[model samples]
Target: MAFDSGTVSFRRYAVMGRSPREPSEKMLQTLEGMSFAPGGSGASQEVEYGWSGGRHVLDTSFSFEHNVFGEALHFALRVDTNRVPAQIRRAYQIIEDEAASLGNAAGKKGVKHAVQRRIEADLRSGRYRRSRLMPVLWDLPRAMVYAAVSPAAQEYLLNLFERTFELRLEPLSAGRLALRRMEAAGNRRSYEDAHPTRFAGGPDGEERAPEYPWVPRGDYPRDWLGNEFLVWLWHHTETEGGVVATGRGELGVVIDELLEMHCAFGETGRDVFRASGPTRMPEAVDALFSGKVPRRIGLIVESGGSQWQLTLSAESFACAGVRLPPAEQAVSPRAVFEQRIDALRDLCETIDALYEAFLKVRFAGAWDAHVAAVRRWIARAARRQGA
Candidate 1:
């Protein structure tokens, strides 16, 4: 969905390389030059993608007013695909084969070849083409791109972005974000030495090895922090009444609507709970004690007379279905857009602050004591469930 008119959902990427903060006429011209064009020359060409105006899939005409909004440039990636149904193609092939066999027993092979060529030519003619659009927002000042696209389509965006602007896009995963924060705070060594915390003990009261299936293999070492952050949120919310103090102010966090947990060791599979206050359910506590961690969680955060709701994916730190606070009515389009962007920034900063809070206790010497407390809490929860 477009960011302008609906709940925003996107994956963030850091734009690397030299890029101008200001939107220029030259950039607009480049976008126009690379705009999507239809019709493929070869039948094997299944997909084609390029730039388009963020307003709609068919709008390739770019201008400052249409695409540029202060330091952010809004646009879209348009992808077109063509494919013939396999069943129909096979039916045609069968018909052709039967006709060829009936007409010429000796030249059946040549007739089949010609039939295949004809079918391929029809496919190349765009007989069955479909188009889709993925919105992108480039925050120039922050050097970040928020792309609303699936993981499978992300490569297309990265390639197109690099080709268009001669810049690289690096995914801003949880591990990378934590590293950046640590470096800025002069605690890089602490982050580098960090590992997953064992919050719950094993059946025999022994510590278990960390198993974080949510963190991608070979990713930055501290990616497990994201999973831990969620577990910490769960514990803190349940025990502390969900009140968190941040730089901005005090915010209330509520875990509701959805809770997804996966076996860290990839042994017990995963469980998903959907309902109001899913975290309070007994099954959720069971999943935690069974060595499952939060993979994604739906949360509501309220602060400063504003409330934001979204589902956070732990590994990539992507927010999905983000519903922001309402904006003032009867404002100009630019004003509305500005308000939305500001609200989005507020949501992001609030989350960052929460993560930083978690990092403080995580990297401190009191971490072992914190783990002991968490283990006690887990044991108490299990006892309550048994009762």
Candidate 2:
């Protein structure tokens, strides 16, 4: 999950508030000051977290060369927690309760107090301490931070990042990005009036409200655009051949590996398809006709002479298990890192371009025509599958 090496998986965040844009003595000093410290939380605390040099759990020695690359700052968040096994704690409690019963009969209250003391003693001794590291990359030019961490770990990361750099982090989800694009394009009203489109109609040719429990129901249901984007991609790839004209040039997109769909109504649950071409599968069409929206999908994008593969989460827009094109083997480590970073940047920009294209049609006056075409395609696909 590290950005410097191996396949990367990360959630994007927009860095907010004030902070230095480049590597400086002050930034280095701040990182060192907030570096991870074992037992820093004291005996009473159960968890502790802070920044690390990202080389290892114990690597807190931050410097310009190791931590900074171009306009990006790289680091890791190290979290340690003290715990006692449930079985062990229960056994100790049983022993204490038995001792109390056999002796002065200190009662339920006394037994509970004794158990608490034992657990606290174990925590203080660090008998069951666990530690983990989450890698983070702060791209100064983009005002974005990419962190390879779980949802729970992200909370710790956000808090520690704010404390260290005096900045806030807001989730850079698909909806948020779309809103930004719409605002920039002066079509904010179009986005505000958007609503979920029913790609597949009812059996009786009656219009039905689209079931999108995950999307906010309001004038500006921007979150629903994520689902629409995936469906659009699937339709575009199947019908239009997936040749998207991006700012960087033409990019070839293929829906490959995996496709995960969930019922928008929160009723039929979810279906997952795994294959060389999951989007072309019969089951995928059935899922779409059954009021399902894609929640995640594996994508392979080719542009210029390079190809990148990654799975994208619709709502959060997180990129997971990204495989960038191979770098030259004879290059130095720094050069390799720089090459990978550039590739990642290209990948992000390509996706953004695709989204921007979708927005143009989405906010256009002829959007209804586009929706009708999509509905026709869905119906035809469903009938072909005998659904």
Candidate 3:
């Protein structure tokens, strides 16, 4: 489970304005006063924020340990709802009993309203709650934070964060990411739909498979630009031996054995494709022909013998399931953490370089020719299958 996994999963954000040298005494006091029981009763433990990794005096024992990387504060926000099953049962029973008492006086809709009100009142009174203290890691240097909770809790944290710090929180989402890259690369052209491809399925009916067969069950908005990056990266790796020259060093990017693709503009119920292999398989290539683009991919980055393995989201560029190179002899945990952070930073920089390269190709009137070459490759692969 992500709750216990050491790997990092987080939403990114950029800090704006001048943050204080440290969380002030007033801010600390506010966090302490607002200490909330993640869940009411058995799990009700107050969590207070405290500075970690630096010299500091202890006020009360911190429920969640916060780490400091330069000016960035890294912590985890965790909410355990393991006790929710019992609470849900109790709430349902109460609603049923109240409905019995109300009879026809309160119709079905009225009873529902009453039940909702009762539950809300109970929640407010701390009679039935189910959040446990699990801290989210925050990294201030890059103005990024990681939250390992449900979307609902993430929204709550955002609100609470603004209340505590009095600064607006901007979620580092796909559109914002695209904008940042575009500005950095000096690619003034808009990519609202800079390129889109359509697919023509074969009579074999296998071609009817969804573009991305392994889409996680969610309603996440599509990341078109990210998908494009993955597709372009795939092409580069296929043709360039999984190695690209970067300003910093030679970056070796391998797509590993897992891949997922989504055709953002494809027909309903036909927008997903999944494949696994050292390189793109025929199925995956077919998905691409059908206008599918990559969403998430397992990648391995190598610089000399040191390597980092991770699954990255094309849109958010968030890294998860990271497996760093073997540790060097005996070292302190702090040293290990610092090394991990450095490796992660290196991976991010390499990805950024690749993205910048993609932008140069995409905006330099080369996209059309690239697309044509890709189409030719797809056709050749199809002909091979028929033969």
Query: Candidate 1: which stretches are off by over 4 Å?
Result: 40-44, 103-115, 201-208, 219-221
Models 1 onward score TM values of: 0.92, 0.94, 0.71
The model with the greatest TM-score is 2
Query: Per-residue lDDT for 67-119 in model 1, tens only?
Result: 98878888999998777778878887777777777875337676678667766
lDDT preference between candidates 2 and 3, better one: 2
lDDT of each: 0.84, 0.84, 0.56
Give the C-alpha lDDT of model 3: 0.56
**Tens digits of lDDT, candidate 3, 25-126:** 454455555444333254333322322222223222233233543343444343433322456757765766676676843566666766666555555455
Estimate the Cα RMSD of every predicted model relative to the unseen true structure.
2.4, 2.2, 6.6
Q: Quote the RMSD, in angstroms, for model 2.
A: 2.2
Which candidate order results from sorting by lDDT in descending order?
A: 1, 2, 3
Task: Tell me the lDDT of model 1 at 212.
Answer: 78
Backbone clash total for model 3 is 22
